[model samples]
Target: MAQIGIYGLGTMGSALALNMAEHGFDVAVTNRESDWIAPFISEAGDLAARLHPYTTLAEFIAALTPPRVILFMIPSGAPMDAMIDEITPLLAPGDTVIDGGNADFHDTRRRTAQLAERDLHFVGMGVSGGESGARHGPSMMLGGSAHSWQQLKPVLTAIAARYEGAPCVAHLGPDGAGHFVKTVHNGIEYVDMQVIAEIYSLLRNGAALAPTEIGALFADWDRGPLKSYLVEITARLLSYTDPETGHPMVDVIKDAAGQKGTGRWTVIEALRMGQSASMIEAAVGARGWSSEKATRQRAETILGGAVGAFDGTPEVLAEAFLAARILAYAQGFRILASASEEYEWSLDPATIARIWRAGCIIRSALLDDIAAAFDQHLPQGQLILAPQIAQTLARCIPSLRQVVCSAMHGGHPVPALSAGLSWYDSMRLGHGSANIIQAQRDMFGHHGFERLGRSGRHHGPWWD
Candidate 1:
């Protein structure tokens, strides 16, 4: 019998099955569409020997060894629910079901509890890295019980990407922690991409740099502290010329951006937890604005467009980009910390950093330093407060300020970068301008304000 069963023969599912089979694990595979099973196995070549294809759910369940571990790679909402309902009766008492999709954490939590009533195990696993990563190695965040972890550790570790010889997979916490972290990871990714795009705009429009020049610049940055998967890919993308028109590939592509909702989910959850994710919010907003391409074009025609040039050096732009990137990561970590407290997940920020250090789109050299900072146990779990990060921020903040000012004056939008700077400024201020707003509120709405020396609510003099 196969050791594990993979339900759903989608891109991720097929790749994971092949990955598992190549690692010498016998895998039972099935799909809603029965026709896909034969073609998948046939394409597996020598790996097909270890793969057992089942056309029916009953046969698929029967093919797996008892106390089974079945991973679902389907859509997360009603489809996932339907699959669970169909498989629950077939599963034994100790069987485990893993949801390996970009699921909402709240749904994961609900499913975890629902399955427990039947004495079965449910794991919400966040699988990262794209198709290539899944076929080779991927970073996995598993949220489940100790029992489920024990059952799947060997296979998961075998297929996971390694950083310094350690697998980038972990049993993060119970229920929803894994998916939640992945959501925040995507949120940070949105901001990271946005900031990079803003820098590209500055270079292209303000500095009048060619695509190849910007590509070379990004390639150079990849060898420095800004080195990352996204940067590396972006460098390659910018350098590519379209075969049809012989123009830069990026120049020919439309400006509209598309999203899968994970970034929006992160911002929503952060706000629900009473934490600020302003950079992520800005990134999400920028994407929304980009979608209204016609509206933007009309607005530009009516109000005019950017005419000023950026006079800053590339070194200063790099530093500014680095500063914004750091602040954006700080915001993401703070949200994770807040969610951990609210959900009692006890998530290890160090572990998260370590896992993200490799096999993920956002993987970078900086994560090593972030992991070190968390190892020192940051005060109040604030990543920005860590001495190393704070030192870096100190060096970069001035450059960030210069970039934001120059970009704004040039009539170029740097929403993510500007938001990061604004958040940093707000965070550092010991006193803020909220008192006047509080006085206004008290005068108009009879809302009370607290006096500086007193704990209890006090009326403002504006009421008199």
Candidate 2:
């Protein structure tokens, strides 16, 4: 096996290093401190001996073999910049450096251009599956020069989680495209999880199902077409019993949600590009509003009922929720597919389907459907719209659309969910009120608008 250097030992880097070690690669792992090194060595003994600890960036770079391959697994924004800046000066020609962190795709593009001057190859890679997935195998997204990708091929393929018949990692276009895909990958995850949470809450509170009962229901979905990580989480979440009195665990927590950044970025970017990412954006807004309980109190005091009782069993309701959840993801993912086209991202929809099939948080059996959708439309570079998916959407869109509308009527906050649902309607129907969108855009910036109602000119500037 070839030698590889990992420059940071955070959860992701450490797991990658361990995976490499297990596979008999001469993996040199380093952190900024000596203390963190011993524990890793202790836990992974034989693999430990292959580990190389370095207190400084310079030393880590110096230890690499000729035609060096060093992967930086550090924090995203600042740490990535500082490490790359420091090491780029010391690197020789043909030496490749891969940033296996969630750095911004635009940043990757700039960094790639900068590294070219020194003849030091730079690759921006997106690694998902969290820590546990990394240790076993991860879903990796590679973006950079095709030449650099070829050099890292076998090792990357060997390390990534395999699905159906494909590697989780793929050469995703040029420059920042890999990171862009990963960024949107996370955006899709946000929509997926939000829809699952909505379904679980509806089942638990609205349908009044007990915790374990729900678990059994989700377990069934695990064996069906709806099977996936999201469903598995539903099972796990429903399994937890309270520690205080050994009762059901969910009643202990408050109903508040928090987010870091990617969801917000995805929605903003999608809107800026004029793509319909309403479901994903609505999800982001719904989470933001959940933190404001006072608003919920007002809605309860003034407005009407939102989600109501389900007379169905866990099995029946589970299928309904899964079908609804499918519509939500399909809506959000469709926006992503469209945005990729508008921005010239050139994302390989098949690889994305493959990656999501195994290592990522949203891995679902639906990936098979996604794969077929991509294969069917590969020559056209079309968004996901296959016959089976259309049937699934047809089965659930009306219910989801009503669910979103009713929530809004009751003054409940639900941006992504509602938007995602609407996104499906807009794409499938194509008779959406573009006039409303154009009117709003013109109202804000006086941007020249196009009108189908009447050709050549200004359709706005009406007094409210």
Candidate 3:
């Protein structure tokens, strides 16, 4: 009998199964289409001996041992729910069902409760790293019952990406925590991508740098603190020239960026939790704003302005780039902290950082520093405000301020970068100007504002 069951055979699912087979674990896979089985088995080649392809769900479930682990890599929402409904009857009392999709946390929480009614364990496991990572080693964030973790740990940890000999898989908490963390991961990813784009825009439009030159800069940065998959890929993207026209491939590609709702969901969750994830929120808004290509084109023609040459240097911009990224992570972790408290999940921010150190799209050397920072400082304080992080930001602030000012002067829309700076400044402010707004509220409406020396709320007269 197979030790584990894979209930989908999509790119990620097949890759996951292949990973398991390569790691010397027994895996049984079934897909919606029966024809896929033979091809998948054939593709396994030498690994086929450890892999089983079942055309039927019954045989697949039967192939697993007692207290079986079945992971679903299907689409989220209604399809995931439908799959659960179809498989619930086949599952034994203690059997586990894992959703390895970009599911809404609310749905995961509901499904966990629903599955518990029948004594079946429901796990919302967040598996990151694209197809290649799935086939090799992916970062896994598991949230569910301890029983489910006990059953699934060996397989998950075996196939998970490792950083300095530590597996990238962890049992985060109960119910929807895994999916929630994944959602925030995507949110941070959105901001990271946006911040990179803003830097590219500043380099290209503001400094009038050639694509190759910009690509070289990114490649050099990749060797430095900005080393990560996204930056590496971006460097490659910039360096590519179309065979037909010899123009940069990125120039030939469509300008619009596509999103899959995880970022938006994160913004919504942050708002509901009363946390300020402004950089992420701005990134989501920027994508929506990017989708209006026609409007942008028309507006550009109608309202044109001559921009002066950028007074900023690449070194200064790089400093600003890193600082913006620091703020982005700060915003993401802050949201996570608030969500953990509100949901009562007891999430370890350090572990989250460590898991993100590899496999995941947002994996970076900064995450290693974040993990260390969390270890040194208590979770009660902001990650950016941690002594070491704060000192670094202090050094970068001058350059970041210059970059933001230059971007504004050059008429470039660096929303994520601007928001990051704003968030940083707002947090550092000893007394903000919002008190005037509070006084305004007390003047018109009865929403009270407390006096500086007093504790209780007091009404104020604006004309006095």
lDDT of each: 0.93, 0.73, 0.91
lDDT string for model 2 (1-464, tens) is: 23779877778988999888787677767787667876877888778777776667677777778778988887878877788777877789988889888877778888888888888778889888999889988888888877788778877888888786677878877777777777777777777777777666656766677888778878887888778887887788888988997888877777788887777777777787766666677677778878998888888778754555544444444544555556555545555567567657677676677777888777888878777777775433434366676677667555566655545554444455566555555665657677788888788877758766778767475634
Tell me the TM-score of each prediction against the true structure. Answer: 0.98, 0.87, 0.97
TM-score of 3: 0.97
Per residue, candidate 1 scores C-alpha lDDT tens digits across 1-464 of: 99999998899999999999999999999999999999999999999999999999999999998889999999999999999898898888999999999999999999999999999999999999988788899999999999999999999999998999999999999999999999999999999999999999999999999999999999999999999999999899999999999999999999999999999999999999999999999999999999999998999899997569987789999999889988988999999999999999999989999999888888988999999999996876789899999999999999999999998998889999999999999998889999999988888899899899879998876667
Off by over 4 Å in 3: 305-307, 462-464
Q: Rank the candidates by TM-score, best first.
A: 1, 3, 2
Give the best candidate by TM-score.
1
User: Lowest-lDDT window of 10 residues in candidate 1?
Assistant: 304-313
Q: What is the Å distance of residue 276 in model 1 from its true position?
A: 0.6
- Per-residue CA lDDT of model 3 for 28-71, tens digit only, reads 99999889889999988999999988889999999999989999
Q: What is the TM-score of candidate 2?
A: 0.87
User: After TM-score superposition, what is the CA distance of residue 59 in candidate 1 from its true location, in Å?
Assistant: 0.6
The best-first sequence of candidates by lDDT reads 1, 3, 2
Between which residue pairs do clashes occur in model 2?
278-419, 278-420, 279-416, 279-419, 279-420, 282-415, 282-416, 283-416
Residue pairs in steric clash, candidate 3? Answer: none
